[model samples]
Target: MHSLSAKDLTLGYGETVIIDGLDIEIPKGEITVLIGGNGCGKSTLLRSLARLLKPKSGNVLLNGEEIAKMKTKEIAKKLAILPQSPVTPEGLTVYELVKQGRHPHRSIMKQWTKEDEDAVQQALESTNILHLQDRAVDSLSGGQRQRAWIALTLAQQTDIILLDEPTTYLDMTHQIEILDLLFDLNEQKGHTVVMVLHDLNLASRYAHHMVAVKDKKIYAQGTPEDIITCELVHDVFQMKCNISCDPIFGTPVCVPHGKGRSVGANQKKRAAI
Candidate 1:
């Protein structure tokens, strides 16, 4: 019932609009993946929805309320955003970093309440980082660091969570792990998750819904099973591919036909001939 939507939304930075007149709905209690080529405004649109960037025209609405009108703290209570490549403070412990998420909940009169402590604890535990709470964030591995950042965001306990490339520095294993964690969050907590992902396979595997962006507009948006067809990939990414069921999950799986191993195999066959 609490959907986030944009109506004729245009977004930009300092006089240049990167994306224009976008109408899209981020369905509640679902994991929505945003996929597009670099510079196609995937991150720009995510930031706009999160209210980190202002809209040039039109409005971004959360539960039928214009997001721009809500006070930052009030908005923070309902929304949390994890940007791409967030910078961690040197020597800052994992617990300390996660604790920052409570900023919106704190006031001059109510500094460190029991509720704050419980939130931080729950977030750390949820991320499986409770044991690493005292370790400096910089000392963690790339995957661990990513988990720490996710934990920080989880501590915010917002109904809507926006993640910009949550798997940037991670290996395949870690990427899947993070995606699984996100999927669980959506399934168990009913947190509406919206993320920008570069990996189409991962998006198809983990997302309940997908949005393909291209040419400053929505190329397509729907369930992965419905939207991740070969035509969509060819149109958005300009690549040929085969789309089939995932053996395990039955989600759409893209087999890119013109890149990597497939191209190598073709070239080797030609050379042999």
Candidate 2:
């Protein structure tokens, strides 16, 4: 199939290096979730893979060729990226936004074609947003807006897709819905899905391969069953947790030990006193 890799990657903002000398290979036709605590560079790493962020050192390779050396349109045809927060122009309808995904394949003279219309329509249908196609993106709720953007990415019809915290601002129901959609895309179409997810349980449920980022490096990488553990969660996230199997998906589920209003960490500490 397809291959994506980062070699000796050193990425960061100006004067701040987030990841240093890291190497990762995206497993073909698998869902890879990048898990880390806040400010651990999960989004930065995703952007680097999509070539949206320039690396401080090294390069991202697609199919063994340096992505930096490829033309922008060429890359767009093979891969797509959906950022965590995307700007939706005021008054722009959902259909218009999804239509933009076809720009990489269109020409000034070629304009609209059957293929473009089919792609946009398919994306809208796939996202269950077909009825909202005429609605202004700015007027939609947060969950609707997220789906519209996801539809745009699907319209690109790329083999590889990278998303950053796609479930942000979505309720639990919608979160599961979105993850289910991505899972279906991978199983049925063989799209190489790479993403950053904050929810530990959801990550474990949906990820075929999980990469735990710790100390700005890869702490572990493998199947969810192999990579997820009570020790890894505590080590990487610095949060005490118990690893259990998900009843529905048969995947690892992380149960965190936290102190809130009831008995937990704080109650235990007070009992010792």
Candidate 3:
């Protein structure tokens, strides 16, 4: 397993800085959720940490060495990152897409071997997509396609996985199902998992650790039960909210109270007036 650390990292685009002087240590073999309002640099930070974007200042360290110094293929062998919406090549079957994940470990002279085949098969089985291996990825539903992409990442066999909004296109049921699969991957296999999640409740439910981002930096980081509070929600999200223990999981759940006038409340008050 590998531990990820960002040290005084600065992230931005062109000349404007979005987040500066940020430092974070991701726990090994656990699910770490990053939550923040839009434009707060959650995605940028994840990209920087994943080595897809270089930090203007400071560095991201994998294990103990700086990531920027590592070769791309070397990094690919140890870490795999899935962006919010990975594009699927037209006509690519689920099996073909997943097989791409093994490229980092392959050589021209030494092509696909028994071990590579087994990895692909195990990845499909682990993600419960073995039966769909022959299906065209584009023909699958949003949830199934997402799982297929995830299976590809699993085929990489990396110790650290960074996922940006793994639940983006799915309905609530599929969101939970995908997250449950990820949870088992962490709990059962002990792979270090880090993801960006907009749903605070789901983050609390599935994540072993939470990092709240606000104003371009980590606002707070800890167990949901310890760091998720009414004030944190208000400050981080700019929304008043009530914090309560989740009914089933006992983790902190956020109930947002935003600026939009409640239609029902407005009607009731108008009738009273």
Return the top candidate by TM-score: 3
lDDT of 2 by residue, 93-137 (tens): 999999999999997888698999999999999889999999999
Clashes of 3: 0
Error of 1 at 11 (Å): 1.2
lDDT accuracy of residue 211 in candidate 3: 95
lDDT of candidate 3 over 1-273, digit per residue (tens): 777999999999999998899999999999999999999999999999889998999999998899999988899999999999999999999999999999889888986899999999999999999999999999999889999999989999999999999999799999998999999999889989999999999999998999998887889999999999989988888888889887888988888775777899999999999
Tell me the whole-model lDDT of each prediction, alpha carbons only.
0.90, 0.92, 0.92
Q: Residue 44 of candidate 2: its Cα lDDT?
A: 92
What lDDT is obtained when candidate 3 is compared to the true structure? Answer: 0.92
Instruction: Give the Å error, residue 103, model 3.
Output: 0.8
Higher-ranked by lDDT: 1 or 2: 2
Supply the TM-score for candidate 3. Answer: 0.94
TM-score of each: 0.93, 0.93, 0.94
